[model samples]
Target: MHVPDGFIDAPVSVAAGVVAAGAVAVSLRGARRELGGERAGPIGGERTAPLAGLVAAFVFAVQMLNFPVAAGTSGHLLGGALAAILVGPYTGVLCVSVVLLMQGVLFADGGLTALGVNIVLMGIVTVLVAWGVFRGLTALLPRTRRSVVVASFVAALLSVPASAAAFVLLYALGGVTEVPLGSVLAAMVGVHVLIGIGEALITALTVSAVLAVRPDLVYGARGLAAPLKLRVGGELVDAPAAEPAPAPARSPRRVWIGGLVASLVLAGFVSFYASANPDGLERVASDKGFDKSVEEHHTADSPLADYGVADITNARLSGGLAGVIGVGATVVVGTGVFYAVRRRRTGSGDGAGSTGGGDRDTAGSSA
Candidate 1:
């Protein structure tokens, strides 16, 4: 949920800003390693940066399609679970953060003053909880593509309520007005629980689709979907495989173009059919009588406020143009950030004069 200014007191907002900043810093470092992409070698492939960028853009685009969750409440993709399953947890945090940044600065959807709150509640908390649950569930379940999808569903389902609880705790600490903490907690959790179901379904479906097409690109499926080997004389034997050409099939261009087209379709056209009801947090805040505390966004006068371009009177065209612009900007920024991280990782490895993981790992590197 996009928390506006004045919903959270200044002290608590600043505290969250500090926490968010620290978390982002940590995530950036972790992303370097997670995205330490192998240079194109005998088993030719593309770097991880572009895929990570697409994750950010895709999250931004899907979030625009708010589905009805209750009578007056709708829910959009939080995307932590989806991104973490597709990319990695470290990169996933950055993806959501990038969307928040774009929305706050350009679209006036989230307030600049409350950016930290949104980042902490929606980005960091969701990613941490979802990723933790995913890893734990995957460890317990059978190692297969189906298991990965199941784990994604469970993790995403739990993450929504966990984020709601975090918001309640923060509000309790720095609520500007007198509100019943218990009531707020109950309403927030109740509405968000419904939203969590939607999150789980979307996360599972997206993860399953990606796994089917390009399992190697899914970070969570790494080491889980290895090709089965033969058992000979009570010993496991590696199956012989054909050598790939110099230019491997793991070309980023195909996936990138496909993802870009899908994002365009979803944001430009499909979003027009999404429910127009208030999202879960907004509904809960209104019902709980705390919505009056929200301050007008500072960027309310921006051309792209509320996901529609200003001065474009046509509802469909205005919204569609804004959505396309948002996707383009997000991809550019996300790719730049990830590309830098990947370069730093590669540079570090070169300086250290170390070959990455040994032969076994490198040989299996498919996208």
Candidate 2:
């Protein structure tokens, strides 16, 4: 959930900011490793860059449409497990960070003063918990496609409550208002449990879709397969067998366009059907008296507040336009950041006594 300003004290917020910065820093380096090696290809890079942006925009849109879970309480996409499953964990952290940044600066969904705390609670903690659980389950469970799906479900389910617990712990340490610790803990955990189910389902479905299409691209699926071997004349061969030809690399433009269109439809159209209830954090805050201290966001007058166009009067058209714009902006910003990271990595590779390229040439002739 997006924590607003004044919920936590100044020192706690600053500490969270420091943690957020470190998380982002670590993510940048991890993203480099995750993007490097055999996985490093032009098309894969193209796909990942825009995919990261789409993730940020998608999470942003989904967060706006809260579905009612109980009286005065609702749930939305926390997006930790979804991003980690679809992309690598490091990139997932960046994706959530981007969404948080946009929400604070553009839409006023979260507070500017408490930005770091929000990122720490929502971005770093969620990603860490989800990834940790996912990895643990995968290791223990039977190695199969079904195991991956189940792991995704468990990981996502656990992440939400884990985040809520973290919030309670933070509040205990530095809450501005004096509230009963037991009440805060119980309330946060209870509501977020419902929210976690929604998170699990969404994460499972998204991971399944990606696995079906490109299991190779899923970091969790890496090395799960036995080495490819084929029988010839009743004897097994040591050499790996070639599979059917791979489909041609689809243009990045097509994938980007399709993702943008899907995001717009979900945010602009389906969002209209979303339950009109305060999300889990809001409900809990109101019930727990935490809402009393919240300061009005500085960007309350932002044109895109509540996900509508600045001047457009048509409800459908305004929201649709806003979704499209958000998708475009996220893609541009995300792509720029990743490209810089990739370029820097490439330069580092070259400076270390070789060409900037990462791999050693195995080909006998130039293509």
Candidate 3:
């Protein structure tokens, strides 16, 4: 959730800023590995990098559709599950970061001052929890395509509440208001549980659909292959062999474009149906009396407030235009970040290869 300013005290917010910065630093390095070398490169380049932007836009759109969970509380797509499924973990973090930044600047959805905290809670925490649980479940279950989907469901389901708990801890440590800690914790975790179910279902379905079409594109599905079998005395005997690498599927450019279109349509057309109720966090804040100190967004007058163009009388057209602009902005920012990471990875790989080659040549000459 996009935590506005004053929800958390200044000192904790600044601490979160440091944590967020550190996480991004780690993600950049991790992304280089995920996107680097011949092992994962080709896919990382045409598919992963471009699709990263699309993931951000998709996350942005999905977030707008906050489904009601309780009478006063609702939940929206956190994008952590979706992003991790579509892209590698490191890039997934970056994707959400892009969305958060855009929301803060363009829509004034979250406070710029609290950007770091939002990133840590929503971006880093979600990715870590989702990926960790997804991997653990897949490893323990029967190795089948269905296992991946199931793992996705469980992982996503757990991630939301985990994030809520994180926020609760932060507030407990540095809450600005004197709200009852127990009440805040219970309310947040309780409603977010329902939202987590929605998150799990959405993550499972989306991940499964993509896996069916292009399993190669999924980072978590890498190296998962059906077990080998052999005929022995007219009966099949189980044997194990390294799984053959998957072939490249459709060009990433195509996937990226298609995903962007889907995101635009969803935000532009479908988001109007999103629940009007406050999300789980907002509801908790309001009910718990912590919402009183909440300040107005600095960009409240932005043209895209509530996702519509300024001075546009036509609700449908204005909202649509705003959605499209958001998608475009997110894509531009996300792609730029990923492209730079890809280049750095490429450069590092080239340097390593050259060093190895030079060492070999020197040894040969001496011999």
Error of model 1, residue 256, in angstroms: 1.3
Compose the digit string of candidate 2's lDDT tens values, residues 171-193: 88778999898988898899999
- TM-score for each of the candidates: 0.89, 0.87, 0.91
The model with the greater TM-score, 1 or 3, is 3
Reference-based lDDT, each prediction: 0.85, 0.77, 0.80
lDDT of 1 at 81: 84
Q: Write the per-residue lDDT of candidate 3 for residues 177-289, one digit (tens) a residue.
A: 99888878888888888999999888888888778776777778876776688999999988866675865445666656677888888888888778889898888888889
Candidate 2, after superposition: displacement of residue 279 in Å?
Answer: 0.6
Pick the winner on lDDT between candidates 2 and 3.
Answer: 3
Q: Can you tell me which runs of candidate 2 are displaced by over 4 Å?
A: 40-47, 227-256, 350-367
Q: Among these predicted structures, which one has the highest TM-score?
A: 3
The model with the greatest lDDT is: 1
Better of 2 and 3 by TM-score: 3
lDDT of 1 by residue, 151-214 (tens): 9999999999999999999999998888899988898889889999999999999988888887
